[model samples]
Target chain A: MNTSSTFPSGEIQRIKGCCISLPGNDIDTDRIIPARFLKCVNFEALGEQVFADDRKELNGFHPFDIPINKGAKILIVNDNFGCGSSREHAPQALMRWGIRGIIGQSFAEIFYGNCLALGIPCATIERRESDELVESVRNKPLTEWDFDLNKLEVSNNNISFKLSIDKGSLGMLINGSWDATSQLISQGEKIDKTIAKLPYLNDFF
Target chain B: MSKNTLYDKVWDLHQVGQLPGGSTQLFIGLHLIHEVTSPQAFAALKEKDLSVRCPERTIATVDHIVPTNNQQRPFADPLAEEMLRTLEMNCSKNGIKFHGIGTGQQGIVHVIAPELGLTQPGMTIACGDSHTSTHGAFGAIAFGIGTSQVRDVLASQSLSINKLKVRRIWVEGELAKGVYAKDLILHIIRTLGVKGGVGYAYEFGGPAIKLLSMEERMTICNMAIEGGARCGYINPDQVTYEYLKGRSHAPTNDAWNKAIKWWKSLCSDEKSIFDDQVNFNATEIAPTVTWGITPAQAIGIDESVPESSSLPKNEKAITEEAYSYMGLKAGQEISGLAIDVCFIGSCTNGRISDLQTAAEIVKGKRVAKGIKAFVVPGSEQVAKAAIHDGLDVIFKQAGFEWREPGCSMCLAMNPDRLEGRQISASSSNRNFKGRQGSASGRTLLMSPAMVAAAAIQGKVTDVRTFFKTNSDQSSKTL
Candidate 1:
């Protein structure tokens, strides 16, 4: 199933693509996008710098730099992916790098929210499932990997495994409510109603 | 139902609504914006044709990219100048208050907020910078948001977020001499692991936190993000109220009495229960410094780094990575490792108290011949105060450059950068590889006083030694 939808008003129910696996725990945001790239004025060019330093140091042999993994749309990472920094550029860069979905053992809190806001689904699987998925993607880069958000399952032709996304986050993904800014605007009256009672906020009024 | 924790009390009060998901729509009383993350957000707002809903609620400044060495217009770096100019334009366009350089109001975003009394107890604060948690020192539930979230806050003045579990970190006992709030936080992060605070709001309290000054509390809360917490806070008490009494934004007279009453009521009730509880002995903490890439990989001043085999299985790989990146063996002692640069600034430890502590250590001493040592105040106000106290002169006499206020060398967004593989003694929060700008450079995170001690010796020296040395020198002079 295609993961991306029409801009600003759609849900990401499923994602299907070839996977590029990067295995390591606590793979922080610094490794994901590096701090230097954060100086840019916008998010458009971030994709080129996603893991730029790592790719450079590892040269042509790095997974993302390897010929087979070029343009791989799904990334499978180990535990605690995107563990540091509040930079949205990390997720924006990953998305710009052509990744539509991520499956890992876990993700940092802010990173997960940032991804969901942009219609990028970040799902978590059991350690064994994660290991098998990583191995499958690494050994067979051409194999189609399918992630079904509704079913909470990921599958290749040879194997299938159940993954977990928090129920609330899952609802947001399925129902297209993840664009929190819109939700926030729609609830403007509710915010005003609450603010009316606050002593501190009342100062401005 | 259990009595509400401090986090619960503050959160429930600020929560605007429950969203379609289980997340709460929390109203942000204050939104702080800096150059690096905000220009894109403002661009997004322009794309959406949206005006800031509550411009008065937002405050803007040029920090992440503003140079600490120079305060002139049209910054040296084109990109840096562009970023600052963009921030200026955005703030002016949106009618948000801009604390620009030379306004005597600008500094590091986190540093300037509290000193200006913009950060207060029981407030729900959001910023695009992670150290926004620094304001939590005032008992506010402050957190860092991404660029999109910044846009959201600017447009709506609220954020949709899942409520976090509250973890009460109880620190008891008096701290030993030379072990400051920085050491305490480093020690806490070391013990709990960097990811330990994930999905939790750390409610720091007990005897130790209670005794710390407001600036020290800010220093501790500033690095809560380093420990992976969404935010951290201390319940506002008499010390907190006293610190806010005469500040610019603080309420006065009858309004002050009313605000204090409300603030007092927001403190966690004695019967409040936390989702998790951890205890630390202040005396057990030493002057600490990070030896590895992550803040959690820290050791005591006199301790050696852990061997890979000695570490837990889950920690071994990262340890190995740190070894390779830092170009040091696993079991080597962190001290006496020669440092090329010493930075005494950042929201984490760039306050007046932090500078005072560092100045005392560097008094009657000169920095080593090869060391590049400098001090950057957290804000222009901090700079003016330091100059008035002659702390600037003391630092300059010790051969450290006394620079203007900004986030200098903290992330090296400006010209203050580490070249090649030079090692740094940084008072800033993160020590990630290349975090100080150069690809292969290394950073050892420590307190400002420890940094001062390191600059003088040209190596990592325990700050307590310098404390004794300075006192002895003074006694002799007298």
Candidate 2:
């Protein structure tokens, strides 16, 4: 359903190592990392704050207290994930936590796009398949989740799902190119023609 | 292709062309940007060595990180300053209009567009913020886009959106005293559940909707996205036209009449078909508050937390989870949870009427010694308007902090967050975990007047108590 132009040009990377399984629907931006962390500019430092609101030290059972998920590189989740306010930090905080990929029934519209644009693959699967991953990971300790970026395939024996990564996003993840201007510049001719057709576009002209 | 309901008409009118993969490349009439999401998009532009394709179509503002308490430069947090600088540079380089810190127009993105007349009926608006649906109040089709999609809009002024199912929410009746538009929306979300509106655009209508002032209708539409609807809008009426009249960005003279004509024609016909329909009586709704992590986990102040057994079997686990996470007991009265803070802000409830209602509640009494209370106007214009009405003086004399406009304590974007384990009585939408800023902070959603009552009692107290105790409902005096 996507073209090569959607992603960057390069070899794709695959997910390797342990994954954290959060079983819930509609885990939102405010819950991913509270707005308190939005003040920081360096996305890399936001890892510690991922799901900070939910991880609030409480009842002696913090979200971050679970060691396997603390620094997990992949996140296997349930249906309709990331459904709430459109804070860009939601994906930024997730990426900071070294979560390279997510498997879920579905992702929030704005959030899915944000994650993919930032080189994070938010894969989609049926609810049953996603639940299987959640159950399997929850039962096992530090289980490996392997998702090949090139093949757009996720497999863990218990469940496997094909991903639909947009072309521009695919290219960026492979080459680590997230510069927006460059992405647009490469498609300059198309943009120029579109702008040229509308007299209103020439406020800058 | 479709032309019956308001949704179909608006959609067909705004369609530029269809892109591949069944997504429509819908043209945007207006684009609003805030400090939080635009930096990355601007960086993408710089990388391409490109400028905003249509600068005038886009408007920028600083909101997410601009402190309501402090407006000083080179902020205490270096990152905030840098991000603000990035937006400033981007707006300048691309010839885009930016309402920066301390600007007369600066406020929350949703609040500014309406006041400045940037958001108009029969137009399509897009923002990198989810609350962009707030613009849909004026009968515009507004969508919240991601940073990459923000890039797309800067490049094309169009968004690739999936078609939505149109749902007609008909509410008819006269609302009781103290029942604000915020309560109406909260009540709807409570009945429908948070995900009920997924893949839909709510067409808010019926006599009760038409009777609401333009600002009140705006408040209703602002929370549509919270219910997972693509957007929520009301049919343009005399109120809508009157509100738009003579506004700075509104069309002038002949253009204005033509615009209104088109806007009127876009309203749903009496028998216009909708994919779904729900009806409600306005009198049945009471001032609502959420006691749990989701907005739907709400009960009226007089009601008790529903017992877990009463919920469907599938919903039990989440119900149990919410009960534990919120430290709330099943069957416990939702009216007495101790509160540490009371905030009146956010695009949802930070309107002038909200401030006025809250001011009336606080006019004669001091805030409980231990309880912290503050009011953040939704926009600079709202702030100025409230000040003109002397609402700020009432707030200050009553011991509540009257701060500048922005989405303060409403998702914790600015400094107005909670301390550890602090429970807040908030007028903002959403009662999610740590939504008020503390990792372990708790929020109790309520009307602004209810928040004022809680501030006075330092607990989840009834707003009716203050109403009776005061013996004055018409005017507030310090």
Candidate 3:
């Protein structure tokens, strides 16, 4: 089900290997990378700020100073994993943070599309299954999620889940293409041929 | 199969071309832009030496990065100024209409479009911001796109897309007193678990929906994205047509009647089939608030936080995490969490109705000391309307900062923000960690009136109490 085939180029990227599980919900784009960091065009440095706002100590207490999820490829988040405004850089930041994909009970539609375009697999499961996955990871920090690229599935022994992706999103990722402008430009030859046959597109050109 | 919902009908009609892979080429009828996401998209076009294929289908505005306090030139932030200038250049270069700040029409892109009637029934609307779903109020199939997709629309006037399944969310019974459209959406989100609507478009219908005004319907559809629906919409009806009639860009005379007929045709039939169906009793909904990191992690104002013991082992862990992060005692009533700040604005509940409701609570009272409260109008027009009615002065006299319209503290790209671990009773969409612009900040989502009440009491309090028996003998005499 080529979920990554039809997007514009560079929209779909592949991250190989096992997964890391971060099960927080409503982790917004700001914490994915603080707004202060957005002034720069580069997305490379954002992964470090993945949970910036939460890392601060509360006065003297360790408020959210937990260690990074140690290179988990796949992230299993709770319901509304990417809630809030549409910030495309969010998935970019998370992708750079090395999260290859997300499996939540739900995702913000725009963020879901952005993730799919960027080749970050976002899948949904029932709340019960999501809750169970959330539990499995908490019990074992080293829990590994293995994603089968061909099958488009994210699973481990304790929790195996199938993903639901729209054909365009799935196709674009699989084909490693989404920068369709350039693709359109490159398809000039084929477009020219098709247009010539149709005779109507001559007016548009 | 049976008759199709508006969602399915619109998706089918907009299917320009379907590829073998299953994703369809979806045509967009309108494209709205703002300064933040457009500069890069335009730059991409320049780099490719491509022209905007159909500039007439697009409109641009400046909202994000526009300071609500000051409108001076060459902004203190060089990047913001540059972005603004770039947007100006791009709009002119491509023959697209740009609404700059302070331009009577300058407003949040979401608010400006519908108010202008550029968004209509059966049209596919796309913007770079997620709140584009606000246009669904007019029964348009709106979706928030990305910067690259923004480029796509600018160049092609269409989106390469996959389709979504349609779900019919039917409501029965009338809402209880004091319940607004905001409460209805919250109830929907709570039942759907934020992610339940993924891969689906919600068709809101029923006696309750039919009873709502267009503006009230807008509020319901505005937050559909928050619950993970691609978009939620009511089928166009007399209310929808009335709201669009005589609007700045609405069709006129014979064209108006023609458009109305088309809109009516797009509505779902009584027996429309859906991928799924859910029903809610509007009377059962209550004014709700978010307690933890997520919108779903909340209970009604009358309910207490669920004890961790009742949660599953996994939820128990997150509950502990939320407890530690939010600094709240387990099982404590969510009603009186001490709030240090109050923010009343956002694409969600920052409309004129929300402002009017908040002003009702703040008119004769003062914001309690030690609480910072402000009301940022959703758009410049909303600000103008509020001032026309003297609602601004009522708020200011009561100690709420009356500021320029923009997506203020909602996401905080601009200067308005929260400080430290201040817990804010906000009317914005999300209550995620640092969502209101401070790393250690905490936010509780509520209606604007509830926010006003919190500002007055310096804590999360029931809003019904504010309106409850306020005309009593002694207090009224004073």
Candidate 4:
């Protein structure tokens, strides 16, 4: 499926790639794409700076700097990934860095919404399940894993486990209904009618 | 029929319709924009050949990267100047009102709105900045959105979002003398883990919240996002109504009573059911500060940084990471830690009252030698008011640089930043690593008054000590 297609036709049913695991929990947006990098007028080229400071501090020992993880397409994170700041650059940086999907115990609400907008499906598994999956992925580095949206499952051929996602978000991922702007535009007449009835808005318009 | 929660009342009133994916198409009553986040959003609109759906409903300002020292054209930082120019051009092209530098109306997007009476009760507000929840103090349902969502709002004047469960956070009793609203919020984030409010809208009420000024309430709701809430609000009351009265955008004369009546109705019903409930005693809260990266990793002024081994299982790893990143020893007392800088401004605490409180502490004192301290008001209005009341004189007398109104040193988008390994006593929200510009910089979040006390001592001295000294000196003079 072409997850990158704009509005209406694109849908993502599955993500297949070797995963790179970042074991930290509460990995906030500032860490994902630090505040200083947010100064740009546009989000392009942000991939080069994703975790820029952290990578530098880790002295090339970080997972993202490791040669084996260079082309990794999936990211396995711990609980509450993307927890602070409403900056869209966090997800933009990740996608630009070639990460196609994320699996974690949980995600910040706004971050979850942003990923859906960009067609990045974020699935959740129980803590124990996520821990085991991450361990397996680490043990057999570069082994391809499949995360199937329709079945809500992740597998590495030998081991498999079910995951969870809100039904609405799952439907949007499967059918490509995450193009909320298109839906919003389609209902333009209704919105106009509603705005006309708002007392405060009447003065402005 | 289900009794409506505050979230439901606001959500139902503003919802346009439910989309195919079950997300509601919510109309945005107010859309706030700033230079850092809006340029790309406007560029996205240009990419699609779309105009702003309703320019009249939008307000633009330059805050994030605007230098606070000199109010001049062609800033020394070319990128900052370029960003401001792009925002100005976009606002002019779209016919949206731009509160540029020296405009008097210009300030932090979150600060200027409420000060101008543009933020009101029962409104659904959206902004590109995360602290947009600051508007929730007036009983509005406000939240931060991404650039993509900002583009969506600019094109359609609406947003598609799923409904959130309501959590009532009941804070009771009275705050101690030196403990302020910033302390209260830090305490809340400390109790509820960083992600505790996921999928929730926190309804802050009870005697303690009701007693707080509108500015104080704003400080509380301002950092609600730090606790992972989608948004946070307090029901409108006499305090809320009084603050909105006689403002530029608020209704006047005959329309005033009608507006109040409608706002009054927006409050959650006494017997309304919440998805979850939590209570905190105001008396139990103390002057608070963060020692770790996440806002939840906070302790009272008299408390110590938690030992990783002593932390709960889920908190151990982050605690260890924070310890290493901060270069702080576990179990070390938060007090008496040397600080290199002190900042008193942000959407979180850069209000008139906050400055006034801090000024009272610094009135007859001077900043400790070798400490870099400064105060930036939330807006031009706040600066003008502070100047009129001699708060500027007090801050200046104490050696704090009185700068122009903008989000200076809050996130370090401007020239104000912590140089390598410099630790700061800041009034801004969030202590995340590198949040204040330098990769190795450290931040200790606190109230503005606490920041003043720290500036005087060059360390995390308790504000209560200053309070006692001030009173004793007053008695001697009298």
What fraction of the reference interface contacts is present in each model, in order?
Answer: 0.53, 0.35, 0.37, 0.58
Model 3 fnat value = 0.37
**Candidate 1 chain A minimal-lDDT segment of 10 residues:** A1-10
Weakest lDDT window of 10 consecutive positions for candidate 4 chain B? B1-10
lDDT of 2 by residue, B1-478 (tens): 2248777876775566544333455667789998887877777666766567678889999888877888888877787788888888888888999987677888889888998987877677899888888888888888787777787789767665557788989998967777778778888988887778876889899988988887788888988877777588888889888988898887777677667777787788976888888999998877788878888788887899989898766467778878887888999998878888899988887878888888888897889988889999988889999999999999999899889777878877667788988888888877877677776788888788889988888888878777666566545554
**Between the candidate structures 1 and 4, which one is better when assessed by lDDT?**
4
Q: Identify the runs in model 3 with alpha carbons over 4 angstroms from their true place.
A: A1-15, A39-48, A54-80, A97-108, A122-148, A151-168, A182-205, B1-3, B311-314, B474-478
Number of the top DockQ candidate? 1
List the candidates ranked by DockQ, beginning with the highest. 1, 4, 2, 3
lDDT of 4 by residue, B1-478 (tens): 2257667887887889987877789999999998887888899888878888889999999998988998688999888888999999999999999988787999999999998899998889999878999999999999999888898899999987888888999999999999999999999989998899988889998999999999999999999999999799999999999999999989987678878877877789877889888999999888998998889989999999988887789988889988988889998999999999999999999999999999999998999999999999999999999999999999999899999999988889899999998999999998988889899899999999999999999999899988788789999999
Off by over 4 Å in 1: A1-9, A203-205, B1-3, B470-478
Better candidate by DockQ, 2 or 3: 2
Span of ten consecutive residues with least summed lDDT in model 1 chain B: B1-10
lDDT of 3 at B435: 75
lDDT of 1 by residue, B1-478 (tens): 3247767877887788888866788999899998888988899888888889999999988888778777688888888888888888888888999998899999999988888888999899999877888999999999989988999999999988888888889999978999999999999999988888888888899999999999999999998888889799999998898888898988877778888888888888777988878999998889999999999999998999889898788788889999999988966898899999999999999999999999988997999999999999999999999999999999999999999888889888888999999999999999987888887889999999999999999999898987687689999999
Ordered from best to worst lDDT, the candidate numbers read: 4, 1, 2, 3
DockQ, all models = 0.59, 0.29, 0.28, 0.59
Instruction: For model 1, name the residue pairs that clash.
Output: none
Cand 2, B chain, TM:
0.96
lDDT of each residue in A117-138, candidate 1, tens digit only: 7878899999888888887776
Off by over 4 Å in 4: A1-9, A202-205, B1-3, B473-478
* TM-score, prediction 3: 0.86
Tens digits of per-residue lDDT for model 2, A1-205: 1122432223348877676777776677777876767665445457677776456454336545575565566787765678787777788777766666777766766687677656677767766666666677778757676787787777666666666565545655666554332443344455455545432233212
